[model samples]
Structures are given as structure tokens and as C-alpha cells.
Target: MEASRQTSPPDSISQDVNPVFFQQLRDLDIPEEAAKQALLHTGNVSAEEAAMYYFNKLENEEADGDLMYKMVFVVNMDLAMGVGKIAAQVGHAAVGLYQALQDKNSWREMAWKWDHSGAKKIVVQGTSVAHLLELQAQAMSLNLPTYLVQDAGLTQVASGSRTVLAVMGEEDIVNNVTGSLKLL
Candidate 1:
């Protein structure tokens, strides 16, 4: 006896998604679950539109009386530093940026909330030293607190090497600067 195979309806198959849409979501660095939820909520609209919807939803959530803080560390991929070296550089940036903000009374509340909320941070890859510097300039233009870490040549990079650029602020504002970059 032969067994019959069942196939999902065309409508259900259409929801499976195209590879290009998934790729776009990956390129945007959206989490897999978030992408899925966005597609579902948006009725499988174009990737760009879905992304906009997702980000808008996030912004709305943040605006509803709960502020979310985020710190982004842009590390120069050209340096090719070892994991330990990169960690050290990020550490330096985080501490330096925190101390700098702590000294300012206006920013102390942000720093305190960030610390209390677990200090959310994302490490993104930068193409080169110039790229990191450009990001720092952009952050400054946005009036976001930024710190650039330069190594002392004790280990991996040369003296005065710009290792990492750290930017800290509200989640939405920080994303405006680092959203295009991919996670390291």
C-alpha cells in the first residue's frame, strides 16, 4: 500500500518567506525571534517596512514611561586584536565613559539607571580606525556621550591606536548611530 503525503495550502506556504527577506533581517542585525514576530505582526510585508514597524513598536514601548539605556562599543576590525585584547579595550571604554558621565550631575541619573538596569551593551564591528573615529564624530554631533579608547602599545595594537569608540545614551538615540553596523 502507498501512503499519501499532505502538503500545506498555498496561503500557508507563502508565509514561509523568501530567502532575501531573511537575509535582509540578518543584515539589519534583528534577532531571529523579533524578525519572526515582526513579520507575523506586519503580515509579511517588505523587509524594510517590517523593520520600520518593529523599531516603531520598540520606540513606543520606550516612550511609555520606561526608559531604556544602551551602550554601543564600536571596535576596529582592522586591528584584528585577540579576544582578550578586545575585551580589555571595551572595558577601558566602558569605565572611562561611565566615570566621565558620573562626574556630571545631569548625566548621573542616566548612569545610575543604566547601572541598575544591568548595563546593556552591544559590541559592533568597525571597518578601520578611521571608521571608528567617524562614528565618534557622529555620536558627538548627536550630543551623545562618547569615549574613544587608545591602547598604550603594551600588548596588541601600537601606541595611541584607537581601539574602541563607546557611545552611551537612550536606546533609540544610540541605535540611530550604530544601527547600520553589525555585531562583532
Candidate 2:
């Protein structure tokens, strides 16, 4: 007996990808930005191949010792933002920091290690915007990456208000800057 071959409808195979790409991205352990770039550069042919390409590109970079790495998000307590707003501000800070570091080869290995090691993050409360600015300056002096989130004024705070500050560096060094602040 001969078996007939079954085929899916033409429309069923979308020209554009759906949720499956997300799973592929997760499985490949590629950052969203890098994955997107790889997909674009490779004509979206294969997630595994794209990830390999990106990883190979980063292989030459050196990672610091396995000492803990931490990203601290500092929110302005004086802003009195709602929980949702605070969360959004933190997200903004994180993405900003990621964007700032994504292009630098020196940060590639650190980012990879951080992602694999659970991406340790701590949210702290800052006394005020001025205090947060001071912390940003301190982080800059220490050669750490810092991102300050400014509100658009469409929702809670006034326009250009500094809402949150995100600092990324080795855990010990980061702690020195934020140790006194209370966790949010």
C-alpha cells in the first residue's frame, strides 16, 4: 500500500513569522537586538545559525572574573509615582542601559555572563532626583554604564523629570554606589 502525502494550506505558512520566533530566540540565547540583526542580515534563514554567527563574533572578547555583576535601578521616591509607573520607568532605564552597552565589544562578554547567570538586578529607592543625578555622576566616574529615565509628562511627572536611574557594573563596585539606598 502507498501512503499519500499531506500538505498544509499555502496561507497556513505565514510569510511573516509568528510566536515561534520568540521561542527560537529564547532557545538560541541571543539578545533580542542581536537576534533581530542576525535575522535581518541572514535573511531570517535560521535562528541557530544566526545565533552562532553572533556568538562567534563575540568570542574574541574577554569576560571579567566570575565575580557577581549587578544592575541597579534607582527610582526617585519623591516623584510618588504609582506602582505601574515605577515599573515602566525601571523598564526604560534597563533598556537604555542595554542600548548604551550593546555596541561595545568590551561589554559583550559581561552581558553574556550576566544573562546566563540570571541577570541579577536590584531596584533601589533614591531620596530625590538630585540624589539620583549625584549617583549617576558617581557611576560615570567609576566607568560604569548609567541610564537616567526622563518622564515624558504625558502621565505622572512633569516633562523631562528624572524618574529612574540604572547603573550596571561589578556587584561590589555597584554596591559601593547604592548600598545605602533602600530596596524598592
**Which candidate has the top score in TM-score?**
2
lDDT of 2 by residue, 1-184 (tens): 9999865536433334333553586576766555655555666677766667677656633343365678999999999999999999999999999888787876766677666545889999999999999999999999888899999999989999999999988889989899899988
- What ranges in model 2 sit over 4 Å off? 1-64
| Tens digits of per-residue lDDT for model 1, 1-184 | 9999966546422345544675687689976656666666677778887789778867776787758788999999999999999999999999999988987786788887675444788999999999988888888898889999989999878999999999998899889889999998
Candidate 2 local distance difference test against the native: 0.80
Residue 7 local lDDT, model 1: 62
RMSD of each: 11.1, 8.9
Query: Which structure among the candidates has the greatest lDDT?
Result: 1
Would you list the C-alpha lDDT of every candidate in the order shown? 0.83, 0.80
Error of 1 at 3 (Å): 71
How far in Å is the alpha carbon of 145 misplaced in model 1? 0.5
